[model samples]
Target: MATGANGQVGHELLRALTDISRDPDPHPYPSPGGRGVQCISPLPPGEGGAKRRVRGRPCEIIPAARNGTLENGTACERIDLADLDGLPRALDRIAPDLIVNAAAYTAVDRAEDETALALRINGDAVDVLGAWAKQHDARVVHYSTDYVFDGSATQPYREHDATHPVSAYGRSKLAGEIALRDSGARHLIFRTAWVYAARGHNFLRTMLRLGAERDELRVVDDQTGAPTPARLIAEVTALAIAQWTDDAAPLRDGVYHLVAAGQTSWCGFARAIFEHAQRAGLIERAPAVQAIRTSDYPTKAVRPAYSVLDTTKLRDAFGVALPDWQVGLDGVIAELANTRFMNREK
Candidate 1:
């Protein structure tokens, strides 16, 4: 089962599963033969929409059939993380073999203002779910962020480095990691950074829109990290799960960084986006990209100046390597083009 089904990672996970199911030689692990995978979480409200509260009621389960399939093959059920009282009922109903927890409070600046809500979802809810996984004897794949580090180190962060979060969002996510580790469930926690996708509201999409609408764009250059694609993260996650399921003896359990290879600052990233969009004919010209320090942005929360994480541990353990940032960016832009064409058809 997958939590945060509508999230960037969750959305891609569903799509990757569909692709895997259609492959001629599917992996032995998900036990394919039409066995369904269930996703749990509400559809995130649209931008600027009021958040909906789910009381202690039976979750609304949406069928997750393949794109062109004839029958319902997978499903995603909406559950409220705040309402722990209703969790037992939801778990009993699903009885999933594997649980992927990709849901979290990701608002970096807003998390400072909503500390209680952030702790409730990122910290307390994780403990609740981890405990449930322990009870059900199921494996869990939890998603984390790069903000856990303070960005002081010069080199790429290793899995064993100390986490000293500079922002409330980072602190809350670190708390979740602690909870997951303490829960005694077989789990894999991935600490990724600068995640983006074509469908979601991310840096790439924002830059493409702003670069088209304006002639000049100033982006932060102080912060540095890898730009991980949501699709690549999803694919690597599936491979990790397959390995864990097949060879339980050599299972990789603990925190590992899963990000695209190479690194770039926010300003450089914006410049790349504009360049790509201009080449794709999505925009008339590349905007004049100006590089500014983090102080210029004046955000409520302090961001890490350098949060580059080393993925050697993940590579050594899982034998999986992430492609370079540019390759991933190209794939995302291509996907965006396809999505635009598909939308035009409708």
Candidate 2:
């Protein structure tokens, strides 16, 4: 079951899972040994000289969210993580073997005022899910953020790096991580940075809207991280889950950094969005994006100055190769353009 199914990553995950379930790639991953290929689909008879045949079966996607309905009018199970008392009953009713907890209290700045509310959903709720998963012997897949670390590192952050969250939202997320670990449940916590998508309230969509209306925009250049697309995150998650299905190549549970390759400041990211938007006819003219320091635009929540995450561990473990940040951005732009063109025709 996928929680927060209407969210940016959650929506993409539904699509990715459907696609993989219907027609799984025979060899979808690189071998951890490097250079060799790994197979996730059904092994053919007498091929590769393997004794056992690994087959991927169709997956049943039970989308659970607070709304209990998708934008496209699809009905889903209602799940309110904030309701701590009802959480276990909801999970019991759903009875999912693999719980993908994509839901979270994502109001970063607002978290300062509502720390308890944020902790209830982001921290305490995850504890319930983790304990339930542990008792039922089910697996869990949870998404985390780079905010767990303070912006002090000059180099890319590894999984084992020290965590020093500076804001209430970060602390809440860190609490969830700790709760899940303490539960002793089999879980994969993916820490991603600067996530956005073609749709939804994200940096990409915000840039497109602002670039069209404004002639100039001031953006922060001090903070740095990868602009990871939601679709890429979903695709990688599906691949990782597939690896777990393969008895010959089961994945170990741990936290891993899942983001697009390469890094850039917010100013650079905004500039790239406008650049791609102009080429895709998303904007008639690109705006002049002014680079400014973090202090120029302050918010309630303090952001990490540098949150670039190293993907070496993720790559070495899952044999998944992430595309460059620019590549992912280009694809999202194309998607936005296609949607625009279709709407115009209608």
Candidate 3:
């Protein structure tokens, strides 16, 4: 069962799951319930959220938030995090062996004022899911953020690094990781940074729109990190799940860093976006992207000066490695230019 099916990673997760099921991917471990994907959440209100499916299997994507009535006639949508008991009811209806969770309160700055709400969704919710997984003997794949660190490290962060989150959002994410660890369930926690996708409310899309309307923009250069694509996260997760399923014992449950290779600043990212945009003819000319310090553009919440994550553990364990950030960015830009992604909200 896939949670938060509408978010950036969730959306691609569903796609990756579908790809796995359709392909004759050899799984060393036998699928307990056979091969299939069932999404617990739906799309936006109007697109018949429960209608999407996988090609060669009994796939389903159910649309329901914690407040909304679940497929089993139980209201398990919006408060699913706060409502612990509702998970069992929803799980009973879905009977999924693997649960991929992508839901979280991701508003960085706003989390300061709504710390409780953020914890409920990002932290406490996982506590409940971990408890459930322990009882049911199921598996879970969860995503985390780079904010877990305070950005004090000059090198890429490892899974064993001491965590000190400076913002409420980061703290809440850390809480989720701890909860998962304490639960003792078969799980994988992926810490990713500077995540942006071509199809979501991310930095890349924002830059495209602004670059088209304006001739100059100032982006932060002091803060540095790898820009990860949501697509890469999903694909790697699918591969990990396959490995985990096949090698039940040797495949130990732990944390891994799944992100694009290389590093860049927000200013560098913007310039690359504009370059791709001009090449795609989305913009007639590339705009002037000026580099500025993070202090020049203050935000309500604190961001890490550097949030690069080391993927050596993940690569050695799963034999999966992500490509460079620019490679993924170029593909996303080309996709955005060719498709009607700009008009998605309309």
Top candidate by TM-score: 2
**lDDT comparison, 2 vs 3, better candidate:** 2
Candidate 3: residue 100 Cα off by (Å): 0.3
lDDT accuracy of residue 109 in candidate 3: 94
TM-score of each: 0.84, 0.91, 0.84
Which order, best to worst by TM-score? Answer: 2, 1, 3
Name the top lDDT candidate: 2
Candidate with better lDDT, 1 vs 3: 3
Tens digit per residue, CA lDDT, model 3, 76-121? 4443655666766776676667778887889999999999999988
Colliding pairs, model 3:
29-246, 42-63, 65-77, 65-78, 66-77, 66-78, 66-79, 67-78
Candidate 2: Cα lDDT at 8: 96
Q: Which ten residues in a row have the lowest lDDT in candidate 2?
A: 33-42
Better of 2 and 3 by TM-score: 2
Candidate 2 residue lDDT tens string, 150-255: 9899999999999999999999999999999889888889999899998889998888788878999999999999999998888778777766656432246889
**Comparing 1 and 2 on lDDT, the stronger one:** 2
What does the lDDT read for residue 266 in candidate 1? 96
Write the candidate numbers in order of decreasing lDDT. 2, 3, 1
Those runs of model 3 whose alpha carbons end farther than 4 Å from true positions after fitting are 26-79, 341-346
List the candidate 1 regions with Cα displacement exceeding 4 Å. 21-75
List per-prediction Cα lDDT, in the order shown: 0.74, 0.84, 0.76
